[model samples]
Target: MSLPSVLLRLVASLAFATLASSLSHAQSGEPGCRPEMAGHRLPIQRVQLAKDEVRLTFVGHATFLIETPGGVKIATDYNDYVRPPVTPDIATMNKAHSTHNSRRPDPAIKQVLPGWDPAGKGAAHHDVTLGDVRVRNVPTNIRSYEGGTDYDGNSIFVFEIGDLCIAHLGHLHHPLEPGHLRALGRVDIVLFPVDGSYTLDQEGMLEVLKSLQARVMIPMHFFGGGTLNRFLARTQELWPVERREQPTITLSKAALPTKPTMIVLPGH
Candidate 1:
């Protein structure tokens, strides 16, 4: 039977979407998935679309600078602790702690996405596409001042660019639930908070890692070597920890590691 042109187009689009989804999962080495470019390491160089690479620099604490191949610069968990050398095109903030957000950000930033809603909304729903990078958030609860839990107080911002899904867990106060994992999608790289006291404890953080199961995990928000070592010791059994001397790293889908790895970058 011959189908109408409109219906044919719709079918084609749906098929393409399904294929893309399958390919994304395959790249992560999940159950029964086979991907073409799963274990290749990209060249270490500046940001360039020719390489399909994005540069991530750890500024300090929960903040990271993400530079895309399409010339879009994004700052994750931007605050006053340490600012990016240059003003970023987009800044994602979470107000769980003072270091996770800044009341007054540089007005020059093109887009400022705050995790919490000042108007008392339950969650901050964001799905903004800028240049070649798409920014979105999965809201999570945070520890409140009065020893209770605050709803939708933090966001786990995810950036999708050039076939890579990068997520930054900002002030993650508790272990993620099933819904949180569903919203996070399949993350290729994750910038995680490793401060046992400030954020999640070692046991709690391990639980979060089990749920996300990202290939590359970048440790952030750690205060000292002692604290960082404690987290490293915990991951020795299941996760391999690598210390990166340089603060910046360029990543591409083809350069992902086969096993889940914990990467440490020096910063405040």
Candidate 2:
């Protein structure tokens, strides 16, 4: 059945609206599921990192709390609007958008870093150790917007805990140029954005993924349902897709994938 042009446009608009509304509800800390959403409840589990056991908790969107192998707590893109407002030993925020950065973090946090600042001083790059885990940040750019750069000062973070090297791509807009790739070096696992508009689209993201050649690919920033499905479909042809029962997956040096694998986690 051929659909009318007007109807197709209407459907597209409605889909975008629905996605925007769902994000709004998440930001507002509203209770209840957004339409067509599934896997909102993260099946919590524990994974061994080195000699220690780490517990991972997903706090919706890009927010995640990680208890290091040595028991130090760390959080990425901490947002209070998400349920259970996370408090961690270290928190990182990207200034690109309100959704990725917060004005204030939990009072209990030991360190808080912003990805960008007004003077373009660049996202504060730092290295710290928590128990046995080590973390570092490398500054990167978001695509230019409105004749200016939005969060061009953002940073992509690398966390080395136990035998794992995890990279978090925060609203990355451009493909990694040669220099950028060199700086990233080796990444065992990657957390990336698959939604087309805000970050790299499916094609661009695939390019980045191929460039990184990380052992495990974990997709984030997708706006639920078919958005995620499309990403999985595109990548599955090249990599095995693993549907994890929980938002948090733990790995020691042992359980890592020998072949490239894409892991999808539930987001509230």
Candidate 3:
């Protein structure tokens, strides 16, 4: 081939590669969960937190209080039954049951993200960025009381803060689909329900866990020790189960366990 023709071909190839890279970024946004917020973020209320650290408190049942490094407070399954001590900056709720959601949220909360659409048109789509954390959801269906399926009735809320992706499986009724896994991206920590009957059977939930393969797994909505113990017994061989006396734990990207571990936080 002539030297001029070779040079033209190489330039065209480079241009195509650049265009593909730009299109990928435009389609997928920044990374884990959703796009990162630009400009000045909200002031950090708690200055003690490091830039790479996040504090999580399991607040009974399926409720969890996730505090970001920027001091943004987020309460998962924010319902009236199991309330957090302080008002949360962002509240995420599901429609599986009354205990998993509240129609009237605290007026002080800056954002209230519901799992499902109230109008019943379609699944609820939320991509919210507050402070230093970005929150998004993957909608899932729930089993209705009438033995029917409530499509897009539940949501798995994923919190992207610092360098970690923490996912809360709110009232999950079945194992996740391949598309759901793709939407979740990468999850470092997972908060899940262990009650076999309420959410999913032992085998089904185990399958979900296997698919997620997160570094840290926390159990919630297990009712009592009996239910929780049953789950721990079944999975102790697969992963290490550690029962902690405290309900809150501080975690960082650099401090995560090398292997998948289940840490049971003390709560209702």
Q: Mind giving the per-residue lDDT tens digits that candidate 3 earns over 83-171?
A: 77778999999764789998688899999999999888999999999989999999999999999999999999999997999999999
Worst 10 residues of 1 by lDDT: 33-42
TM-score sort, best first: 3, 1, 2
Report each candidate's C-alpha RMSD, comma-separated, in the order given: 19.0, 14.3, 19.8
Task: Name the best candidate (by lDDT).
Answer: 3
The list of candidate 2 runs beyond 4 A from truth reads 1-55, 83-86, 144-147
Using TM-score as the measure, which candidate wins? 3
Per-residue CA lDDT of candidate 1, range 1-268, in tens? 4569889999999999999987776667665533321221223345365447889898777888899888898988877656676778999997645677767888988999999887886899999999999999999988888989889988999999978999998988899998999889999998888888767898899888888889999988888888888888988999888889999888888888888999888886
Q: Poorest 10 consecutive residues of model 2 by lDDT? A: 35-44
lDDT of 2 by residue, 171-262 (tens): 78878889878877899888888887777778999999999999888887778778888878877679999887777766655677898898
lDDT for each of the candidates? 0.84, 0.73, 0.89
Q: Compute the lDDT of residue 232 as modeled in candidate 2.
A: 80
* Error at 159, model 1, angstroms: 0.3
Cand. 1 TM to true fold: 0.81
Compute the lDDT of residue 31 as modeled in candidate 2.
Answer: 65
- Native-to-model Cα distance after best TM-score fit, residue 32 in candidate 1, in Å: 58
